[model samples]
Structures are given as structure tokens and as C-alpha cells.
Target: MGNANCVFCGCIEQASVGVVEKWGRFDRLAEPGLNFFNPFAGECLSGILSTRISSLDVKIETKTKDNVFVHLVCSIQYRVIRQNADDAFYELQNPKEQIQAYVFDVVRAHVPKMNLDELFEQKDEV
Candidate 1:
């Protein structure tokens, strides 16, 4: 059972219950009815990096140097180690918009830095 004051419970009640995956790691768990969350559970995800707390994810796709048109996806996970739920919510907008903006900014910054030939020639550099 969760306390009425619990943010998780409130979110479940007021909004839709959605599963949030950490960096595409862990089977997305129900957003509702969770009691205390242990960071140890983070290990359940083999390739995904779990944050000590809940985090945000960002993904993007772009073409390769050879114009190979490769799809690239990236995710960034950030958690509030301070345990301030209010602060986290206020600082980071809901995942979708925030993630889109972050991915775009990151991709845009990196794209210009590399030339088509550079990307193809230095395959391992990136």
C-alpha cells in the first residue's frame, strides 16, 4: 500500500499509469502501486544504465557519413539524487517533450562536427 501523500500514488490516480523504462532497460514497470523503489533493481537491465532514481530518456536517428542513412538512437538518463520530487518535476518537463528537445540539440551539435568522409573513414572514432 502507498500513502496518500506518495507521489507515485498520486500520479497513478490523477494521470495515466504508464511504464517508464530507464535507457530502454528493464521491462517497463507499472507506474502505479509501487512502494519504495530500490536502485538495486537497476541491475535487472543488462545493457541499460539505471539511475539511482527515476531518469529521463532521449533518442534520435540520423544518416551516416557515406549517406548510408543509418538510424541512430540515443538516450540520456538523469535522476534527482537529492530526493526532491518537486524539484525534479519542475526542472524536467514530462519525458516526451524534454527528451525530444535534448536529442535534437545533442544530434545537431554533433552532426556539424563530422564530415561524411570522416564518419565513414574513422568508424571507431565516434
Candidate 2:
């Protein structure tokens, strides 16, 4: 028998929330604090989801419209919406990779249409 008073407790660290799944499915969310759940029964799993604003820098190498090969470093800042923390955590297995992929896609799509000189002149527009 599982210990009655030995239930698992999780602590959602500062600037982060928690996603609790019951039997391999999402059940609810736990805000930052001491969260309690049953672990011995294998009924629940909790994962911490960060809600802090963070930045990602991606280095992409691509050819410009002028056929100039260039290396560009793009930096973006983002955060998981507090109310959408569950979706962010569940929908994205690796948030960093997803962000990087999106950055690469956007940069490649826009940069290739502009010459190197235009790219520098309209950096903010891109």
C-alpha cells in the first residue's frame, strides 16, 4: 500500500509555473508555490514551466538577394504567457529549438529578398 502521508510535493520555482498531468494527460496547472500530488501511485506527473522573459540568439548563414553569402545573428526576446503556460509546455517539447527554427525561417525568407546594403539600411524593418 502506498504511504498515506507520503504524497509527492513539488515546488514551482519563482518566475515559473507547473503543469500537472494525471495518468499521462494534462489535468491542471499549479502556480508558483508548494504543490502536492500523489506520486507513489504513478497517477501524476508535474513539470515546471518557466514564465520568465528570455532571449534567444540564432546565427544563420544564407545568401542575400545579391548572391552574397552572409552570416547573420538575430536576437529575439520572448516569454510564455502565464495563462498559456500549459500549452507552451505541452505543445512544445523543446521551446528553444522551436524558437530557433522560427527565427531561421523568418530571417531566411526576408533576408534573401534584400541585398546586403538594403539589409543593413532596413535592419529594423526586418
Candidate 3:
């Protein structure tokens, strides 16, 4: 059974981090490369998180002040700060959904007040 426990070894890739948990609670972050944990001792690799930059595209549909329907694609780029890896992992269970809500709120609030040309000209400001 001792040898069987070694099967839980995990190979973490470059630019990525491993979330280690002890007895089902977050333990620590493991660096890239081979990492070993003993499940027999209640230690395991809970998840893998990327330190590299990532981009998310959110589509928004709202109306202009002139009542023109417009669809916009907003690209949001983000990266996990290695120092805050734990927060990134535990802070929000559904970040994408929360982000979508924020984007939707901001666009919906601003778009309805701007004319089509104003929206086009000052989109970056919004």
C-alpha cells in the first residue's frame, strides 16, 4: 500500500502553480516541476493554477440613447499574481460569471446614455 500511495504524484508545468491541500483544506502553492504529496497522510494536489496571462472576451448587447441596438465585444486580459495565488484560488468560485455581471452593469449603465457616435468615439473611456 505504501508504493500504491506514490501514484498520486503530480507534474506541474512551467508558468503554472499547484494548489496543495491538507485534509481537504488549502495548504500551500507548489512551484513548477515535479511535486510529491502523500494522500495516505491526507495531503493532495487540489488544483493547478496558471501564472501566465489569460484573456476573456465578453459580448455585450445594449441600446444607445437613440435606441439603436449595438453589440460590443470586450476583451479583458488578466494574470494571476504569484504572490496572491491563494487568494486567486479561494476568493471567487465563479470569477467569469462575476466578471460578466460587472461588465454588463457598466456597459448597460453607460451605453444607454450615449449616442451612437459618442459611444464609438469614447468607447475606450467607457
Candidate 4:
């Protein structure tokens, strides 16, 4: 016979939040600090979902409207929305990669429409 465990406890760091899942499905969000869940025969799982806002820097080589090739380095700040933390974790296999893909798409679509001079002048706008 196997020993049965009843309680599982974990801590969420101050800078991060957590997600709890049971039987491979999302169960709830855990706030910072110690949290507990029923093991229910080893079906419960929990871990940190996200910390504070994270920054991603991407370098892109693109052509301008004037046909000039330019290199751009962009920094993006993002976080998993508190309400959608579960979706952020379960729905997306790699959130960082997804954000990078979106960033590349947006830059490619818009940067080519602006001249180098326009791009430099309104850098913050982009």
C-alpha cells in the first residue's frame, strides 16, 4: 500500500504571483506569500506564474520607406495581467517568445512606412 498525502504547501515570492492546477487544469491564482492546496492523491500542482513587469529587448534590421536599411533596437515592457494569469500560463506555451513575435510583426509592418528621418524624429512614438 502507498502512503497518502493530504496537504501541499508552497510560497509565492513577494515579486511574483502563482497559479495552481489540479489534474493538469488551472484551479486558481495564488497571491504572494504562503499558500496551501489539497494534494488529492498527488493531483495538485502549483508554481510561480509571473513576477513584476518584465522587459524584452529586440534588435531588428529593416528597410525604411526611402529604401535605406536601418537597424533598430527596441525595448518592450510587459506583464501578465492579473485577471488573465491563468490564460497567460496555460494558453501560451512560451509567453516571452510570443511577445517577441508580436514585437517583430509590429516593427516590420510600421517601420517600413516611415523614412529614417521621420523614424529618428518621432522615436518615442514608435
Best TM-score among the predictions, by candidate number: 4
lDDT of 2 at 20: 73
In candidate 1, how many Å is residue 79 off? 1.2
Best by lDDT: 3
lDDT (Cα atoms) of all candidates against the true structure: 0.43, 0.80, 0.83, 0.77
Clashing pairs in 3: none
Worst 10 residues of 3 by lDDT: 1-10
Q: Give per-model CA RMSD.
A: 13.0, 4.4, 4.2, 4.4
lDDT of 1 by residue, 1-126 (tens): 111121222223222232333433434433333333334443121111123444445455665534554455555555543334333433554655766786787675665566677765754544
Judge candidate 1 at residue 75 and give its lDDT: 53
- Candidate 1 shows a clash count of 0
The lDDT-based order of candidates, best leading, equals 3, 2, 4, 1
lDDT of 2 by residue, 1-126 (tens): 112223488677899887777656677788888888886555454567688889998999999999999898888899999899878876787889989999889988999999999999998887
- When summed lDDT is taken over every stretch of 10 residues in candidate 1, the lowest stretch is 1-10
Tell me how far the alpha carbon of residue 115 in candidate 4 is from the true structure, in angstroms, after superposition. 1.4
Each model's backbone clash number: 0, 0, 0, 0
**TM-scores for candidates 1 onward, in order:** 0.40, 0.82, 0.82, 0.85
True-structure Cα RMSD, model 4: 4.4
